[model samples]
Target: MSSGGSAQRPEGLGTRTSRGIYVSATTPGSGKSLVALGLAEALHSHTDRIGFFKPVVAGTTPDADPMVALIRSRYNLDPAVCRGGLTAREVRKYLAEGKREEIGARTVDVFSEIAAQCDVVVVEGTDLVGQDSAVEFALNARLANDLGCPMVAVVSGRDRTPEEIADAVDVARKELQAAHCSLLMMMVNRAAPQHLDEISAAIRPGVSHRPVYVIPEIEEISRPTTGEVSSLLALRQIAGRADMEREVRDVKVAAMSVANFIGVLETGDLVIVPGDRADIMVGALASTFSPEFPVPSAMILTGGLSPDEHILPLLAPAPFPIFAYPEDTYHAARSVSEVRSEIWSGQRRKVASALGAWSKRVDDAEILERLNLPRPETMTPLRFLHELVGRARVDRRHIVLPEGTDVRILRAAEILHRRDVCDLTILGDDGQVREIAGSNGISLSGMPILNPATSDLRERFAHEYARLRAHRGVDLPRALEAMLDVSYFGTMMVQLGLVDGMVSGAAHTTAHTIRPALEFVKTSPGVKVVSSVFFMLLPDRVLVYGDCAVNPEPDAEQLADIAIASAETAAQFGVLPRVAMLSYSTGASGSGATVDKVRRATELVRERRPDLAVEGPIQYDAAVDASIAATKLPGSNVAGQATVFIFPDLNTGNNTYKAVQQSAGAVAVGPVLQGLRKPVNDLSRGCTVEDIVNTVAITAVQAQAVHAQTLQAQAG
Candidate 1:
């Protein structure tokens, strides 16, 4: 509804003509470029009209942009058709030299030229939703708007709130404007299969008009990083890293579980067995990247029974890390099988990373607590129980609702609550909810319940509505009716400030559940746009993407808004943001409306905010590959080494993303909404119990963030 400034729109200069879809998000790292690239790769099954773009880049490399190179090489586009003009170093120079006008002019020229040559362009973003001085976000959005292309929004699943999803869609739609585009689809990537139903239902209602696709979290591949291997084995670190070591090397590992040992074992390996019959086999793991081990890496000893304590002295001198589990051989093997995925996927170097951090902490127990511990053997209950009691504080009792919710979600909630992690407020017809639970073989003894039909609806609504709707919409009767119609009874409890957050949508669309929030709770002040994010879980990597669920075609400012949201999302996941601006041409090489949009957006980002790290007019390679980066752009943090990638438009956003999902076996989490006032989350109509639980967690986090912000504002 609100435009940032004239700079948000891009002026079109039709230069090149080609055919392809452009995938761009409101922000970078929202899986736009990856999606586009994947889609282009996937289209191999359909047609080959696919063309890639890094249309307008902020800087240049020695020869051209890395993204352009990828598009040229993989997508089969002509080198002449490729668009990135800037290198990583150039982008840094623009920032350092303070050449705002030069940056804008370069971007416009690049995109314009690429748009003229390519049939479809998959554009990526630098950032989309947060407020920052960066201009690239705005530039990507404007490129899409100017080019009149559609877009698909991508989001993550972890702790996503319905309000966030709704807000993202709302902002994107508002920014893109229905008049300029054909359609918009929101995709929640990396959603765990178990949570699919609940998440789908929760998010469906909010996006009924637009197509919302939910992709399951695909188990991805994870291999040891070179650093990880060196750290794990205490091998000498090598410079000039290559995919393969220069020569065949022998490595060994020793641990309590054969399963743990097997994960790090490569082909042609030898294994040691404890004097136990069960030592021979562990259950099959999800993957064995090397398929078979001709030789075992190492032999493991099981149980406290010493295959020899003498081995410990040997282990201490060995190159690999070792472990001692006080369990039987069979039990150790079982533990290994249970944690096979983790063992196989984890980098050997996480050990070094862990040890490094652990050394700084004074307490050893805390370090053990933080590690994602594998399943351990049962210990004596008395001492363990005593320790647990001593460490844990008393948990406050709260209402728990069954309300015919899915078993998995309820179980997850119970688990979290039992651990004293959260206090839940559940709504339902208590007795019926319980009866159904009993019939369904669900246990609810420890949970608290409340009946909304018999509860004081007026009082609850008054409380929540007073806080959320106060001056904005005060028609209590009308609001109540609206709320009831949309299952607002539960939402009202939250609105009235009676509850921390609400997670729904396992049985509804995002629209159905999020509508009430948008209509009642509204957006935070100065929050002009909404976008989505996806927490992609690759076998070995985790990433966050945005604006993949909403916004058909965003302007530079809107893209900027998405970028801010994405950066914050990345921060939550413990990743640093190094953004990439994608287009057909890199850094002013081409001329077109799309390039102009990216140019202005880059300028906007550099001039408006100097603290953030970002670069544009580069392709996926320049943004991700360090080797290509050194040769191409040389000194930029983002080029050929970027973690956050922005796409150009929706068609590119939707198809390309899914292609990656299906092909690379990458798991995706959200289309989590950003830029909302309150924390309300939606589940997919087909979401599972896990989805519901995760959505609840996401809502909690959002609620917490909003609360913290409110306190800060009040204090200020």
Candidate 2:
């Protein structure tokens, strides 16, 4: 909220319609950053998937939007999202080319990418550059309208009379109305204590359509920390290093006599003057000790000077802090005054104080009810992942990673830990894994690291695996030898309930990852073979593509089992279970071995579970497009609304899923293995850190489903 202006009401960065709120400011210094933080805090109470996006930011590092960085770290969000935006240079270039609409388009593109990741993205309203206030705010209004998100206007309450604040709020409201963007509310941030009630009542009649709230200035959050002053103003702290987090309540230039300046001394004040003013410097230091005098929080010796060499001895004896700056007194004082309040990522004390202040000042119950945003009816990749993480946490599962020596696995493990998605155990030597993590700047500080070769559980797991594989001619010695392998050790852990599930194969082959599980852990009851599905995240909904991984080919019966299992997997992850038996034909239009197999598989699915909606021998186009469905398969329930597509073989399923993933920019989640007794998943060897994290999350959620089924069976 420190970027500029008072805090926003509700944080919303909408990639989808009706998902986020745009918080904009009509005037400079409205603390939009803090307002956004306030909104996000409230959003956290209802849901954890909050996103922060700033469409354009100037005078900051590229790709480091101050707002996005602050909120992402504070919320422990997946860093993959909300980081993309048009830089100031890009925006200016677009504006100069008269392609301003393109800016909106790009912002929307960024929104879509993050939209999949966040339940509600807290889109920081477009920052005003050098444009006129009217022009900038009008653009924000239009952008909000274009993004189809509600707008909450922030009005600066600092140094402004109630009337001035009301007029500004009125202007912003009109801009939003003129652009046809829904105005959610108006907030007056940093309002003077005396004007809180007055400011709330003043933005009325003309502003009556939406609610108005006023937040009084909190000095701790509204004033810059001494640390910021030192860093921003280049005021080198020669003393009082311990008090860097203290807030500068007031800034004073020591142009007056020592006596007069002493009169102005107050708690948390930063005094600026020429360094040669030894009398004032000594007096200011002494004031901290007097019962009659107020203590100065810090002092800056301007003109590139410090306290006289002799006088420096008396400095630290006093509790007051001091700084040395190169600028003259006038400029130094001006610079200190210009330092605005902010919430930075690492500034814990300030952020904590700011959040605490906003929590107390804002009315929570009333605001949450008024800004009641509806949940997205469509499932997005990010939203689905959010749901998966949420589900995994609800019935917390302990997931193990067999490729702990790989950096991707460690990074993912750190992410899973940071997000609190599930309990995790990494399979490798503790020292090697730890060294790799540290070398990559990754922290698995509190995570469990189990060395498969040395773990005491290996003895128990060896016995369990040997007993389960005795028919395969395995003995205790052979099983004990297998226990040294990470995949085998990890699978054995899952089978024996040492851990709930295993996610491997990032560094191993598919056979290397799943063979152990297949050999001992085995498939669940009534399951024939382990099959897989890829949840293709199309623009509007999620579609399941089955038989994509494990099995290369299957008989009609195995295909039917895949269909049935895929339907259940879809339901478990919150997708509807409409089965489309995909082939090269639509209905009876064509015939081939593949087509016939799909048709038979469809009949078998219907026979096994009449509750599932199933359609067979359906072309891809007919299964997805309504017009094609009407022409090819009239009166069919699953033809056009198919949520699960059952491919006849692994070759087709794998090819189609990849084609869609690349051509349509769809997110392909898994080769999620189904029909396992306990959850075990594989990852691509070339998978990114995020891929590992997502797979681990999926595995944990799968483990949760497994646990639920076992509980139900025991009860029955």
Candidate 3:
């Protein structure tokens, strides 16, 4: 990761320095919006104070750029600030009069003003097109340098060969670098799936210094919606207004008989014919509801003809849209074929699919590190939870919920299933769980429910548990008796690799929930004691409180281990760790057994993890409040900006977290246990559906990291 550009402070823009990233393309139709959308969505995980700008929009209106509208609506950006700096016509007119420098200066001024309000801004460049394409590309590079932001170039690989793809990327990279723009990354969009290896191999050696992402072609994003087609031909919609957003994957002509046309139809096909062809229109409308025949997206009546009175009555209840155009059938079909599909605000499914595809194909963490933008001062709770869910949905892991009969657990399972966050298996009697879910109006159709007492795995699991616990004097009969417990059964399943992780404790105590894992799964190698942390989501930022639910009182070594583990947990969830060892007194103002223990623990942490920043014997006020920090410990780095707060004892940690959570209206999402060999997280006994969902998501992400580490170890 490298920050390759010099800082520039433009006049009249307040002292606040806002970071910006420029997303541009080598040519038109490179799917630049997809990259921008995914980048924005990814950035939202880190911070919600984001702004979007287009330096040169094609039209004058604020809504002229569909990309801007899509981003604003999806991310809830301020509408007043999410507009282009200048229109295409305006830029062209200025350039024709040789005002190139004026264009760059104006862009810089507009971008800086918007940047002042946001932590970061994503600037989109004009598409490379028209007679001035060469000039436009050159201007894009110059604008990036003028703004002092890093650039990411998107190259189209839709119909290019491996050599062509490499050459195109090289040319774009050289152009941007020559203009003193820090090229952060290159994305090859719409490449053939089968040729991905060849294309990547050809381009990697040339652009080895920077990360290159290759996205295979997805056809769903290339298909225009019915509403877009209707707008293109200026057709008057007759019925099915609600279905206008349905995608049109193919275009078909209904010149033959109804029987022949039905045979030629395909799913998402747009049927075009004269209004007099009532048989074809009726047949196409009926096919949309049939399971056997392919469904048409919509039907177009050409030649400016209206359907007969009898036909209008039949089309009133159709599920697909019906449009009337003044052009003939031939001209209408030609126009529809020439209309290029694009992602717009109205087509949510397409935008979501595009984001998902880009997320799955690209390495977002690597890109963010390369850009190395400044971190936001605070993160909202909603944005934090949304990022957790998004990370869990990528390469999903199977998780088991032991207390299935509990209503909260069942409700959480339903929500997780609906969101497709993870694969779930519930432990309980299937019939009873189903009955309870039915009465609560919860759907558990796809989730597997099993009774520990009657499941076939009970015998096998008992045997395996007895063998693993033989050293602890466990017998086969004892193992069989223990397997009847849901927590024990679920833990054995994880040990046997049947599930990736386990979440229990909604109806049980913390000891009961974690005993099974301690007996078998145990802690990771070299870990002396297990610790836990609660993510206290405050109004402005996230804070980590350690040992709140685990150790009652830890010695210096245990406390140091707890601090290290807490810092790692915070970083895993996207918060940069700045360890603050909290005590009743700040610095050397007071001396006692408690303060001495904290001072020792701080020393141990610094000795063990030299790379981490640790501050100790600090009062709560001095640790968090900037003014108090300056008065108490003036030169400390972690005094006022600490993200991870470690308490000397459980009494302080538990009560402080509760006080802040209640008094400040914060969301405490944890007792996230660390140092486990496999991910087995415990929930609060009085937890809500949202709490269970968030804990399960966190567990899934932990399992993913463990799996990656195991693969890396094996390869090494």
Candidate 4:
């Protein structure tokens, strides 16, 4: 394998440039070139600026490749890059001498030219994993390393057992050390319809860590005609109905010149030029023999140029279909490139069939790339909730009131529902709730308030409570008293699948909410304790601090549980969870009960679930500061930076987060509830209407998740 750093681009190059994709395979005759070409065409469809780089050709001549030539010609690129026809001598010599270094140099040189002018360059490697005969028999891995580009390994279509498939993948992974390179995804080309199931099953687990896309084979190659291309460019017709070889008919062509080439130009088209500059065109045309379309259709030379004598002779020797525009070559080219972007993007008649074919091949790559792209901030819940006000979903949304509900809580709920945030419901009567809200100056505009106290719920709940708690307790009065508590009743509404997730805790503690859930809704069987995550929003990134609001001074086992829960919650929010068990010191630096708890928690976490990405006993700075981490904990997974920070206790968790928020101006959103069997959030007693709405969204999401889980469980 060849090994070297990426070559730097020449300075002062134009902004228009291309990146290169080096497509490699495990073995020869695997359609690597075909796939590479298709990728180039697909990328071209997305962007006009691109260059194809094939660094090594075992049996090629002078960098000459017919496919490369076709792309250059079809795109109207500089002819100096026509490898198949122009670089035949060089390719032949390389093959004769087997001098791969020369090939590498030439490849780099060609790419340098492309990089300077293109946005992305696509480099297709020779067939097979280790086929580098043209360059010291170097491996593709080394080439990718040198190019400093990620690679997409292409495998062939064939029937194989899961083990066999995994074996093949294992070989590639081991050779490339993909874990370090982040070689994101892979493509399985030419898969058949019937083979998809078997292939998917075989590769799913093998490539589960990476995205694997299957590309079906196309039956034929379809190319658009040149006339159609021109028509499409001119917005005359949409092309690509037929294959590439179709004959093109005569079409109007626009040409610009300062010389007297109008007499040389065919008549049916319009030409723009200076009346006095016609001679400049003729002088240039006199020295050139490249075929031009016949036309004296129209000429508008700028600078008042008129047609010269030599222009007519030039026209006589030209073919049919020609017109002249008012600008020089420079302006004409600019106009064509701009006005024809649609045509360039498969908009014309000669739709490059290869481009479509290539798109199919790299469909998986596109998906993976999109997955890596950043999403809009508006998609976040906190941002979405700032606009939503009361009664958003149900017309008469049922709001449950827990015991000891305070005026602040009731007033906030009224504002939320009146603003259409939720339908307000109270444990007490409408009159009493109104009296309470009015006393607090709460405007319950559109709110539909209800009181469960005097309503039939006392009796209904009395009976339901007996039915649910018949053996647990005795005495109707005592049972009614217990059932009448807000936590018990509110939790009952959720358990009976009546309302969505409920938010409480103004007059209650976290233990109250936790107690009802454990008694009624219960925790997920897989979970031990209810952990929470706070979406800590710093000026730059959103940090997820977990078990901060819950789990005070948790033991190693509890910390492990918190770590797992936090990691999962982070994933739910689209973050690739990297759990960092935080402490005052990183690794083994500090000796203390808390440090041991964090370290032991990290170990327990790995023992319980080895698949998770967990790091422990890392200080805040070491967990988040790259510089500090590199100095103290080199190579530790969670040392340099962590997205999920797991604290050992509520004191550290709450205080640290509050300090960050107050002192650093961080927006500490959420103390989002996690590990519940169903989604229910506990709002801070001092929360605002906005907080209620956000909690509602979280509840809604949790409700949907519970519904989905029920269906999945039933199906299973």
Candidate 5:
């Protein structure tokens, strides 16, 4: 649909703005519109208040514009907002008159109306056909900047060499940068089948921060159905009008004998034969019912052809539509061949097929993550989770869910799998898991379910467990029994590099989940104690509290390790690490055993990791409140700006985190266990599905971080 907004909003339209992503194309026929549709569908799954906008639409009328009508109907977006954009004619007129800024001004004026009502608007750029692509490209860049939305650039790869496609992508990136438009991701659509790998490789190195996807051309999506042909060609239907929606895959001119024509018939062939050929009609109609024969899409009888009245009864039950034309067979065949294939909003079957193909090629989760929307001034729980999930999606990691028997685990697994946030393997009896999932209306059709009891890895895992714990006198029998426990099996998977991480404790104790990991996975080299951190999402920012879930009665040395690990964890999740070794007193105000332990821990942290910014022996009020810190610990770097707080022992750590979580209404995302050889995170036994999902995401990110560190160390 074209621009639907009036010149301006009604009385008192303030300057409030909205967040959105712009879908722009490198050239025409780039399938950018399809990407917009897929994006709207993806956003709908996350929220219902979704909006679709086009800065410049192909047409002005909603009925005349298939894409805008489709978005409005499919996503239930307001038609007015979907149609709110400038027509190409209006944009060109402004540009031609040296009024480029006018184009941005008018578009933004319209966008403001749409953005005012919706949480996010998906803005589609201009179709590059019938105009100079350079101008259209420049216009897209300007409009994206004016609307204050990041872009997902769709590069057209069809009919171009890999080198040319790469060149186009580079040009798009440069132009966007020149206009100061932010890029979210790069998608190359309709890429040549043979050159997919090359095109994808060439365009990615320059934009490593963004995810790149190369989707090969799908033929079914470009084929028009019989109904579209009938509507476009104005054919008179003879029979089976209901079957006109069948696709016309190929065109066949049957001017030969019945036997000869039947031999040439192929599936989805639109047969154009002369009228009154009873023999030809019978053979074609009869083949439709036979399983062995190829099914024709529809038959077009030319030269005013109509079967004899006596044969009308036999043709009434035709599986495909039959149409009559006033022209000859040659013209009818030409018309069928020239039928323009377009993804119309009315064609539900074609739209569904197109979306399925689009989804297969495009990872919407990664795209959403790359958006990295403008953050709020305050770090709310929702915003923290958003950032967490986004980081995990950018590079997916395989995480095993050990507590597959728990309904919450199953549901969270399904959600994670469906979102493509990461690859997940569920450990349990396959049948029972599926039965529970099925009974609960959860679709685990494509999710991988691994049964540890019957798996080939069981024997290997048991042997490895025995070997690793030989000093503890664990024999094959004892290790084998331990391997039967899903937690042990999952931790073994992480240790053996079968999976990137493990997430459990949904249906087990914290000890049951962490013991296996501690026994076998152990701690990374140079790390003295295995500790945990809870990401305390306060009203203003996210704070990390360490040794909250593990390490009971830790001494000064162990407390130092937890402080360092927690600082690293905070930095890993995009928080600035200002370490605060919290105590019962501020500075040297008190001299109790706990205060002495914290003071010693702070000294140890400074000696070991001089690069870390750590301060300690501080009270909670002095550690957090800048005004109070000024009164108590003057000129202290981490007195009031701490993002990582290390507790002296588990008794203080656990209770403090819990108290803050409940009393402050803050979201405690973890006790995310850090300093492990492999990432194995534990969840609360009473955790919800959302909790499990977040923990798995955190684990995946930890695995990624660990891997990067290993790589960097090797290179060093």
Candidate 6:
């Protein structure tokens, strides 16, 4: 039954060029779908161009394969490629008629075509059912080898002793290895809580080459929803259709009196009783809506009877589903007990539960490392945005929003607060800020709002400002007047270490917002000039456009510094830095003073930081397109894979960023100022609430990096 070969040392399959993994199981009901879904989600954080393939599907039509549909819909994968793989009947018929060669060729051709277009693919194997067990095992092994991918074997641990679990894994591992398919990892699913340690210890020695993971049985993923039960039992809908998707954890038969039935009820319980039991039906429905009692998932009425007329209207508004069946109470209960919940397209709760459990239980880092899957080169817009918030939350930084009264700023503040991304302070009149927020439907209850004119820090900040600016200024009066302005006051907070960063410019000019920072916060110790970059979130990847909003026209050395700063910024934000110094012509194709400046800047960058992959005097097309780059700059490393784009001047950089932002519908997230002693970012006056939120998140992350560097320096 297995694809035959000598069992040699198990080597990892899938070279650096290979882009997929095959997930298979030794037995049916191994929770293979759960593992597949979780694996897809985990890979998504690394790359968005993930593909799913279920070669040898079970049903005739695509709709019968719900897992494929669910993965496609949830991750927004291409529909054309996401249809289920070959049907089970087709494969089974071919195998029965000894058409193994045809099946193998077709599977390889189809999988190659799909894998070529994706960064990674997850291939699910056929279920091992009665009479087809040997054929299924052979097919899974042959497909894994033919696809040039590693195999993840899942073993069902339910009702199995420790020795049995180990035996199952050992046999599967040896079979897969003999078929020349590398075993990436083995997962023992649905094992008893107390038996998990024993089972792991038993299987550890048998599969010592690869890791073994044991996922405890989770009921949330195992229980059927009310809608599924209705479909399974052919029951008639009484009412509460809106709540049909609620999950059923336990099923109870209410044959006793109402008092005793109430005591036995639990949350997500499905009650089965005769329709004539008015007391049980009414009480079950009432408890679902009550705050004091456990809410049942649904109520099943049996015995071909109906509830009282008054109960019908109440059922309509119940928080759970109500079903009526013609079968007697005993038969209905028996039918319910045998129902098995399955993972389907519409069961979003179950999908989410599976992903959560897998993320918590699996050691994904070790698996990815063993597979030799490198870090992805590009990031999607959504993943980038989420990573910003997640990175900020790890070490919460205090951010101050000076333009707090502006509606967009207030809205962004509310969102950041709800996400718990950062600790925030707003410098403005407390009462006026609350009033404006209330009118705009935003809550600022727990956020601190201060008025510089009435605050205790006003005098202290004014004194500090006067002392810092003593050579140019006369007295404390001028400093006090400047402190009344929110921008100046907020910048003082960052300078005094009261807040880690400040985001302004929503309603103010960039000059007005950054003037105080330039005066007091200044650049980092080694940096002579401060610069900024915009994170242009294009459809496929994120690009960094630097000095777009700063340094209008720089000389050669300044441009070099900007290039280095932009590269560092890109690396900090999870983008690999392949810098392209953009100009009007490809390398040495044309000559002019502008071109000369770029060429000199490129040389300066190479001289200063030899580690950076940089190329210059390149046109935009050559910098981003591989074919053009091949013709223009044949051996240049950074020409075709540029992630950080450094512009020659403000006129070129600003216009290009705007054109791309408007035409391509890209999300430009900065004007993020770099080289500051602390982190101070300026927003566009035309920015949206989302733009402000993103800026604050970026600021928080920047502050965290700065803090980490400082700690390292002190320890050294």
Point to the candidate with the largest lDDT. 3
Model 4 vs truth, CA RMSD: 22.5
lDDT of 2 by residue, 593-646 (tens): 888888888898899899999999898899988888998999999888899998
Clashes of 6: 0
Q: 1-716 in candidate 5: lDDT tens per residue?
A: 12212122111122223367789986788988777877776665454356777777667542357787777876546676677466767777887898877777777887788877766788888867765887787778777767776677888888998889888878767766666666666778888878877887776345454447787775656888887888888988887535655667789888899889989987678888888888888888754455456567888888986789987777777767888899998888777778777664356545645655565677766655544333234555555676677678777789999877788898788667655578999988886776555333344657788998999999999999999999999999999998898989999999988899999998889899899988989899999888899999875578999888888899999999988888888889989899989888888878988999999999999999999998888888888889988999889888877788888888998999999989998888987999998899999988988888899989999999878887899999
Q: How do the candidates rank by TM-score, highest first?
A: 3, 6, 2, 5, 4, 1
- Per-residue alpha-carbon lDDT of model 3 for 1-716, expressed as tens digits? 11224443221122223388888887766888788888887787666478899988876764588888877877667775577788888888888898887788888888888888877889888788777778877778778777876677889998999889999888876766666666667889989878988988898444435557888776767888887888888888886534666778789999899998888887678889898899998887654354456567788999989999888888876667788888899999999998888765446556646765776678777766655556656688867887898889886999999998898999888767755678999999876776556433345768999899999999999999999989999999999999999999999998888999999999999999999998889888778788899999987789999989999999999999999999999999999999999999889888999999999999999998999988998988888989889999999999988999999999999999999999999999999999888999999998988899899999999999888888999999
List lDDT for all candidates, in order. Answer: 0.48, 0.76, 0.82, 0.55, 0.78, 0.81
Ranking of candidates on lDDT, top first: 3, 6, 5, 2, 4, 1
Cα lDDT tens digits for candidate 1, 331-386: 54544433211111222122212222212211323312322123223222222222
Clash pairs for candidate 3: none
RMSD of each: 27.2, 14.5, 9.9, 22.5, 13.1, 9.7
| Residue 580 shift from truth in candidate 2, angstroms | 0.7
Candidate 2, TM-score vs. the true structure? 0.59
Superposed model 1: Cα runs more than 4 Å off: 1-408, 418-420, 459-474, 485-487, 630-632, 714-716
Better of 4 and 6 by TM-score: 6
| Candidate 3: segments with Cα more than 4 A from true spot | 1-18, 79-81, 178-180, 204-208, 393-395, 398-716
What's each prediction's TM-score?
0.43, 0.59, 0.61, 0.44, 0.58, 0.60
In model 6, where is the ten-residue run with the lowest total lDDT? 1-10
- Tell me how many residue pairs clash in candidate 1: 205
